[model samples]
Target: MQFEDVKNARDYIVYSQGMHSYSKAITKMMDLYLSYVPYVERAHQEGKKAIFCSALYPTTWEAPLLYALDTIPYATGEIGRLSDFRVMQIAEDYYQFPIETCSMVKCLVGQWHIRKDDPGAVKRILGVSSGCEPFNMAWETMKMQGFDVHNPDVIYRAKGVDGERLENLIKFFIRQLYRTIEWVSGSREFDEEKLRLEIQRKNRLLEKMRKVLELRLKRPYYIRSLPTILILNSGVANYFARPEEFEATLDLLIEELENIPVDEEENKKVIPLLWVGTTAQEFGIYEAIDQAGGALLGFRSSPNKLFREDVPPLEAIAYYLYDNQRAGAEIYMRRFLDEELGRINARGMILYGIIGCSYNSVEREMHRNYFHQKGIPSINLEGAFQLGGPTGQVLTRVKAFTEMLS
Candidate 1:
């Protein structure tokens, strides 16, 4: 069990305390807990200027904020990520936005919509845009909820950026980021040398975090989500001002990682199954796979990575400031079907086809054939993400598939 001070809203603090104390509801609430909460908190609280950024292709535009704040970073993801299973309103209270909105995205947006008691949210919310309807729709949803959303930064999908264009865009992003910082901090005199040094420092940190994740992937070194969360401070624009907070959060999580037992339970050799498609399914699907002796190694039928901003560093901050959304739904589909499918050595796929997401909604024919040619079994279930069916078909199909594999 990890030990640390909680920094989210009081409920989150209570949620954290409950988990550490081994409270009965912990199992149910565990998924909502920000595995890297303290680390994210630390990043924002550091002494330097801070701005918060959130997105899919964060590698791009976030760079400008990093340079501008001399320390700002990404916030850890919203509390209820796509995978939470236990149902209950921990974050969104339903008043912030219409319940008709996509539940998963709304789970993240709920802070502005349903759960508005916390005022700090107004201080650091920056939403990104991808070239998808839902991306803009979600932004609108936030706006409807009264969020002070600035114009979205976009990411393009025509082709992944490369070479000179990438360099120019990156430089442009830095200049735009300066404008944002000036607006927020109400001070225009930022030190140039500090910005450059911070960028170098950030590059080193991204590389280090990647390496750490690689290690965790290899040996259950499981960095405990803290360091990655700290790295996201780079994504959040305001963390620069609160370096200590980011550092503290990082320390708490890293400590958790170091203390974790090296032993990971052996997975069941169930049918080689793949989950294709996005919109986070109810929690425990992955945990179920792990506990039931099976694995959903990768996503297959899911939407692409939404709102990615993997643009090159800006030549001027304006380049960064512009919206450059990617059709993550489209990208993830091609990569999964066109690329990752054959590689995973899967026997079947569980495709959760979400409605209203045009990107993947149109790919049904392409994916079905794509997997079949690869000689993989697939099950398509059409329904709201968390609520599949009462007869437990999802679980039943999973069990049957695994039994067949065995």
Candidate 2:
């Protein structure tokens, strides 16, 4: 289905046929999309400077800078459309970009080539090279292709190993973020006040997000309500523009959600599946689960205590980035699951073993063992990056899992 404008496309995507009902999840997503798509389009139209991040980056610092310049910040992996995904295939098959590389990187780099001829396309990139070699290599290739690039070197140190050393590293990252901000600002003077306001607004946004997550964990009703595309579009494109409006929408959502009581019978009808693995890019995996009367609660492993509303923006962001729970380190991952499983009242766990992700693939057995010991059955489903799975087989497996839980 095609739409005449971006807003229509966004509307259709967010309020798709079966999802036309009014729900807190639908309302929140609509609010986000209305703000998100237009902001990116306006930035593209006005020739405002934009930066493409290679992965998820802290937005408290990044988004404010873009807002200051009247620009937009985008995550290459999260923002890719279906066309971009197809371009990634062409890039791998025809252009000889490594097929074994990360799907996010492959699609993002491929999207760059597709948009390279357009004068309006964002040419500057901010690449994070701390983890994922494919992402690092993709940025290197983009640099070679003449895109202006900045990559901050970050090393992962296990928490509590060296407090002072960690503080020093965070300080270094703060400096790198400041430098990147200065560069992104171009001729405009860097505005600390604007950044402070943005950070304050983002703090509210995070608070709202936390509330939303908490609600979901407590009453996991909206799991399959929104498509992975819409969910991830907001996740990736969220930082591109307005913070206050975004926060307000979130506030509205939380208020609405708080009043809604859990439907015990409805909840009993379907199995709630706690998903662990890569971003479910296939989206069909989710649809299949829905068809089989399962709710797919996507990955959640945040160290909420590490972030503070009153903390310095740089420190908060650094802490967020450094949080092992956010990065899915083994110890923290186990802890996160342990904490969240009961909250969501999940019947089972599904570990999506991505082909290229050594991290999740290797941890599958450990996760299975852990879940099994807890008397919760779990299964490991293997697929390519971003859930590149055979649709029929994936659906079959999803049905089988649901049947088992039933």
RMSD of each candidate relative to the true structure: 8.5, 4.4
| lDDT, each prediction | 0.43, 0.60
Candidate 1's C-alpha runs over 4 A off are 1-77, 80-100, 108-110, 114-123, 134-146, 160-179, 187-281, 296-356, 363-368, 378-391, 402-406
Candidate 2 runs further than 4 Å off: 1-17, 24-42, 54-70, 84-86, 93-95, 186-189, 217-219, 222-233, 236-240, 301-303, 309-311, 382-390
Q: Candidate 2, which ten residues in sequence have the lowest lDDT sum?
A: 1-10
Residue 321 accuracy (lDDT) in model 2 = 58
**Residue 182 error for model 1, in Å?**
3.8
Which pairs of residues collide in model 2?
Answer: none
Q: Which candidate is the best by TM-score?
A: 2
Per-candidate TM equals 0.56, 0.82
lDDT top scorer: 2
